[model samples]
Each structure stands twice: as C-alpha cells, then as structure tokens.
Target: MARPRKPLLSRDRIVTTALALIDEEGLAALSTRRLAAELGVSGPSLYNHFATKEAILDAAADTVVGRVDLSMFRDGRDWRGALLAWGRSYRAALTEHPRLVPYLAVGPGLRPAGLRMADAVFGGMVEAGWPPAQATRIGALMRYFVTGSALGSFAAGFVGDAAAYDPADYPHLGQAHLLARHREQVDEGAFETGLRALVDGLALQYAELGAGKDDAQGGAKGAAAE
Candidate 1:
C-alpha cells in the first residue's frame, strides 16, 4: 500500500471541503487536521497552500459572499430595484450557509468579494443621490438586516417535533409539528416582508429628500429672477 504522490489536493478543493465542514458542524468543528482528513491529504500538506487555518476560513467566507449578485447595482436608473435585488441575493447566500453568518456578520475583513459588494452598494446609493453618510449607513443597515434574518431561523425554532413545545408553557400550543411542515414558507415569507418594508421606507426618505432639494433650488432661482 502507498499514498498518491500529489496527495490529491488543490486550494479550491481544500476551501470547498473546509466550508462544508464548517457549515455542517460549526466554526469550532474546523481544524487543520480535520480539513486535511476531509480532503484526504496529509495534514502538513495543507500548510503548503494556506499559512494558517484563518487563511482558509477567509477564502471560504469570500466564496460565500461571492455568491451574492452585484449586477443589479449597475442599473443606475433604478437604485431601489438594485437595492432590493442586492438584498435578496445577499440573504439567499447567507441562508445557504447559515452557520457562517456569525463570522461574516462581524465584518468583511480583507475579503475581495465582500469589499466589492460594499463598494457596489455604497457607490450605487451615492450615485443615485443619497448623501455619503446615508449611503454608508445603507450598506451597514442591509448587512445587519440580512445577517440577522439568517442568523437563526425564527420559523425553524417553532417547527419541530409534535411535543417539542408544551401547550401550557408556550404560544405554538402543540402546533410545532404543523409549523414544521411549512417552515420554509414561513421563514421565506418573513424575510420577504422585512426586506420590502425596509426598501419602501428608504424610498419614501429618498423622495422626501428629492422634494426638499427641488424646493431649495426653485426658491434660489425665483430670487435670482427678482
């Protein structure tokens, strides 16, 4: 018996498997040795690609963030639509990797995809006439909203075994199993509802700002005419 010469390893392969391990288990579940075993390579071999476990984690996080669609931001004619599209895609990516939300929620770190996403969002809003301060806040606001939605599914908490929730002690009233049947629908519905409300509020604010600007400009023009 003998081991393969190359040990069957690639940076992509290692990162993919590592992310899966973290997603299936948790952050603590990942280790250099565990990842090597999952990839069927020597533990020391992993160090050749990544200097440390943190590097691999960073790559994995970037992969998840990369799934988000940023194309909508290019639609300068409709910033609201672009924002809604961004929020939906961002939430979808995070929902797929719920376990990783905690780490990602803290910050983007030096991840390229994450940085690009921030840039696209902030730049799009600013280009659409939002003040710089507000544009910065919008990026942060959406990240918080999307990450919070994915952190722990509210529907999942109720959708469980028949007796998981006691009738007298809780609100579900033994309906946990029933809720379980529609967990996906409930959770998705909640995300959509919250996302729409946020965008709608922002739209109103944008309109108000536009009106204020027009008023100021008209007043100045009338005075100059006088």
Candidate 2:
C-alpha cells in the first residue's frame, strides 16, 4: 500500500473534534467509536494519539482553558486588576463549556496548558505580595466559585410561577417569578458582583498585611532607639 498523501490524525485535530462532539451532544455523547467515526478513521487510530477516552477529555478540557485571556498577568498589571480580568475570562470560558466544568474541576490539571494556567495564577498572586499559602487558597477559591456558578441555574431553579408560591406562606418570593425572565442578565450580574466582592476582600487582606508589616518594622525601630 502507498503512503497516504495527507496526515490522518493529529493531537489538535482529535481534541478539537472531541470538543465539538461535547459541545453539540454533551459529554456523554463522546466515545472513541463516535469520535473515530467523526474523524473518518478507525477507532484504534485514536489510541495512537490518546491513551484512553479520559485522556482525550482532559485534552479537550485544557483546550477550553487555553481560550481564557491570561495576558493581563504578563504586563505588570496590578494584582487585583489582573485577577479580576483572569477571573472573568476563566468564568466566560467555562460558562461556554458548562457541561465540562464538573470534569475540569476535579482533575489534577496534568496537561501542559492547564498547568501553565495554574502557574500563571499562582505566580501572579505571589508576585502581588500574597503569601504562597494564601495564593494557593485564593486560586482554589476562584475555581470553586466559578465552577459552582457554571453548574448552577439560578433562574431555572427559581419558582417562576406565581401559583407555586402562595403570598401568605412566602411573602418575599411573590415577585420571584420575575427572576426567571431575566436569567442571563441576573446571572451575569450576580457573577460580576461576587467577583468584585472577592477581589476587594483579597485587596483588603493584602492591605492589612502591609499595615502589620509596617507596625512590626516601627516596633523594631523603637526597640533599637531604646
């Protein structure tokens, strides 16, 4: 048999096709057989690129993470500003792949792109004067908030029917029916609000640490004078 004129498969092609499958049919629809069929290749050909289905899923998930804007971290941007930008980008990327959030959340991020994201976030925080431990916690905190937001449908869960909430029993929820109508706006607003609060809280903590350091330095100076 003659060698093929064109390449049959590549890692990028595999991951991209897997992502398309997930985007169109949800994660459950992705399988080696289905992907191979989609790629116009035999199922065994996929194994040459990815060791297993889980490996392919991990690559797909990392590809989504790769879409996030991390440039803010490279330009000497203030910590809070960079973090806020990264958070919004992260959330937006994950929001587009809401079905994959669950898988991305639990993984160890063994892929190169995912590991680079982790490094940027952690290094950015430390460079911004956060203790290593605190920086780690902050990264985890953002991941938790963003991933949880991706999974939750506040509008869908809200009782949109007035009949569902009796005024006598639930006075506060009487106007809750309107919440469902503004799902997109409400969800985006809530995410932004929470992102601001988180960033502001971290900033305050950083300020307090600075103050503590100043106080300690002043105390040492007074002792030297005595």
Candidate 3:
C-alpha cells in the first residue's frame, strides 16, 4: 500500500520559507506563489497554513522575534544592561534580514512572541521601580526608538541612496549627524548610549516616586497619632 501523502506543510515551515524568500528578494517580491514555489508546495496549499501573503509575512516577523534569547534579562543584570542587550539583539535580527526590515517598519499584527518580549521589558521596568502605567509607556517609547534606529540604519546603507532627508532644514539634527560621522554609526553603540540615558533618567524618576511614597506613608502614620 502506498504511504498516505505525508503531511507536507506546517505554519512554522511556511513562515521559515517566507522569510528565506524575503531575505533573497525583499518585501516587494514576496508573494504566496513565490513562497509556495520556494517551499516546493503548490500555491493553494499555502492557504491551509496562511490566509494570505500578509498573514505569512506577519508570521515571519513573529518568527524572527521568537528567536531572541532573553536570558540576559533573566540572569539578574541591571535593567539598563538587560534592556540595551535586548535592543541590540532585536536590531541585529532585523538587520540580518534587511528586506524584512521594511515589513517590520510598518504596522503589523502582534504575535505571541512579540507579546512575550513586551511583557518581559515592561516587567523589568516595573521591577526597576516604575509604576505599571509608566512602565508600559516607557516600554513603548523604547521600542519606538530601537525600531526607528534600525530602520534609519538600514535606509542609510541602501546603495546609491541620497540623504533626501535634508538635514539643512533641521540644523540641529544635521549638525549632530555630521559631528558623529567619525564614530561607529551603527545601532549597537547608539542603542547602548540611548538605553543608558533612559535608564539614568528613570533612576531619577524612581527616586522621586520612592520619596513621595515614603512621605505619604509617614503622613498617614502621623495623622493616626494626632
């Protein structure tokens, strides 16, 4: 008896295949047919795993995030170091797949892996003495900065690309970029510096909050005695 047709495909396989195609041809060239061909499967078979190319791309994005090893944070390093490391790792993943950077640059669906990373970052912020609401907001800002830096770095490296970003119009930014021309303008150095600055700022905020809480508790005790 002929062996039943092997279950030939799965979502993970499809996402991995899609990412490979994206790495090869870029976001513009990715399509359901292209992905299926790359995976050695028929186009229709893709639908069983992903509803559309967008869905596949979304899955691929999440797959990239899912690959991150968050053990640095788990090992009890200070939040500053952990956050900087996380940002560096995230940027590295996107940088490795330059074509995938554009898709990540856009608004995409959040996946379980992305949510887990977000939770970890937010939890770290809270452990560092931030209020829940403040921690979430700060987490969003950090994400924005890291993503923006990655996209900018990728865009700058595009061959024959002009700085169409007229720094002339923004004197301060233009001057800053020009001044940093001699430095390693990559994401790692910038991410670490920015991350440390944020952590230092947060430290001041935390101290203020701690002082406020202590004052309030002391006031309550004094009032009880009076």
Candidate 4:
C-alpha cells in the first residue's frame, strides 16, 4: 500500500490534536505518545514538530488565546469600548477552558497569538492617550483579573448548609448562609462591578492627564507672551 500522497504531520495538526486531548482529558492526560497515537503517527514523529511537551502545551494555550476577538482594537475604533469588549471576550474564552487557565497563566507568551494579543492591548491603550508605562500595567491588570475570575467558582464553593454556620459561634452569619443560593448572580455582579470600576478609573486618569497637559500649555503660552 502507498504511504500517502500528502504529508501526514504538521505543527498545526499536532497543536490541534493536543488541544483536543487536553480539553477532553485535561492536561495530565496529554503526552507525546498519546498524541502520536491519536494522530496515527509514531512518538518520534511528534518530536519533528514539537521539541518537548512544554512546547506542545504552549501551542495549545496559544490556540485558546487565538479565539479571543481583538477586532475591537482596529483602526478608527474607540479604545475604551474596544477594551471592554476585549475583556468580555477574554473572560468568555477562559471560562470555556477553565482547566487550561493555569497553563496559560504560566506559559511563555512568545507564541504568535499570545504576542499579538499583548501588542494589540498595549498599543490600543497607548493610542487612546495612555502612557506606555500605564498601558503595559493595565494590560497586565486585565490579564490578572480575567485569569483570576476563571479560577473561581463562587456558587459551587459557597457554604450552602445552614448548619455549617453556627449562630452561637458566628452572630453575624444569619444571612451569610443564603449566599450560595445567589452564587451565579453574585459572582457575575461582582465581576461586572469590578470591571466597570477598573475601566472608569482609567478613564478618570486619562481625563486628569489631559487637563494637566492643557493647564501646562496655557501657563507656557502666558509666560511666552509676557
């Protein structure tokens, strides 16, 4: 029988299969041998496409990041609005693959998709009148917030048992036990509240900087005229 007309292995194919394996069985289940088996190739063939398991994992994480919509940062768009949309999309992407968040959080971001994401976010903020230093910090802050949110399960972790909270030992715990009933609402509400606060705080800082710049220019004009 003929081996095949076309190439049977490629980096894209390897990354896609690796991501599927992780999504279905989690990171622990992934191995070059398993991936090779899934791809109908020998274990040594995987080494041709990926140097190590860490490299494959990095590619898988980048695949997830690539799903995020960064079109909001396109030319002629409002940076603040774009940022809010990006944040929502980022959170949504991570929420779908919560198990992958840890790898994404620690993985080297040299991959194309990850690098593109960082560039768009930082560049968009700078275009919107933010200092480069501030943009970099804000980009990191957004990543931290989105990743942290993905890690939490407020409703599932909340203490639902009324008996768990003793009134004798906890006088102010009367309504605390009921929090579990509203876990989804509470967690979502908290995220929205914090997101809005972060955006608004940045907007305020931008306005202050603009005002200070105008004041300095006016003072300089007056000095020049005198």
Ranking by TM-score: 2, 1, 4, 3
| lDDT (10s digit) by residue, model 4, range 1-226 | 9888878998999988887787788889889899999999999989987899989988888888999999999856787788788988998888778778888886336889989999999989898888899999999999988888887566667587888878999888777777878987887787788888888998888899899999999999999999
Question: In candidate 1, where is summed lDDT lowest over 10 consecutive residues?
Answer: 171-180
- Model 2 C-alpha lDDT per residue in residues 136-218, reported as the tens digit of each score: 99889988888888876787678778898898899888878888898998899999999999999988999999999999999
Q: How far off is residue 97 in model 4, in Å?
A: 1.1
lDDT for model 1 comes to 0.89
Model with the higher lDDT, candidate 1 or 4: 1
Off by over 4 Å in 2: 1-5
Assess every candidate by TM-score.
Answer: 0.89, 0.90, 0.75, 0.85
Q: Would you list the clashing residue pairs of candidate 2?
A: none
CA shift of 193, model 4, Å: 1.6
lDDT for model 3, please.
0.74
Output the number of the TM-score-best candidate.
2
Worst 10 residues of 3 by lDDT: 153-162
- lDDT (CA) per prediction: 0.89, 0.89, 0.74, 0.86
* Residue 182 CA displacement from its true place in model 2, Å: 1.2
- Reference-based TM-score, model 4: 0.85
* Model 4 C-alpha RMSD to native: 2.7
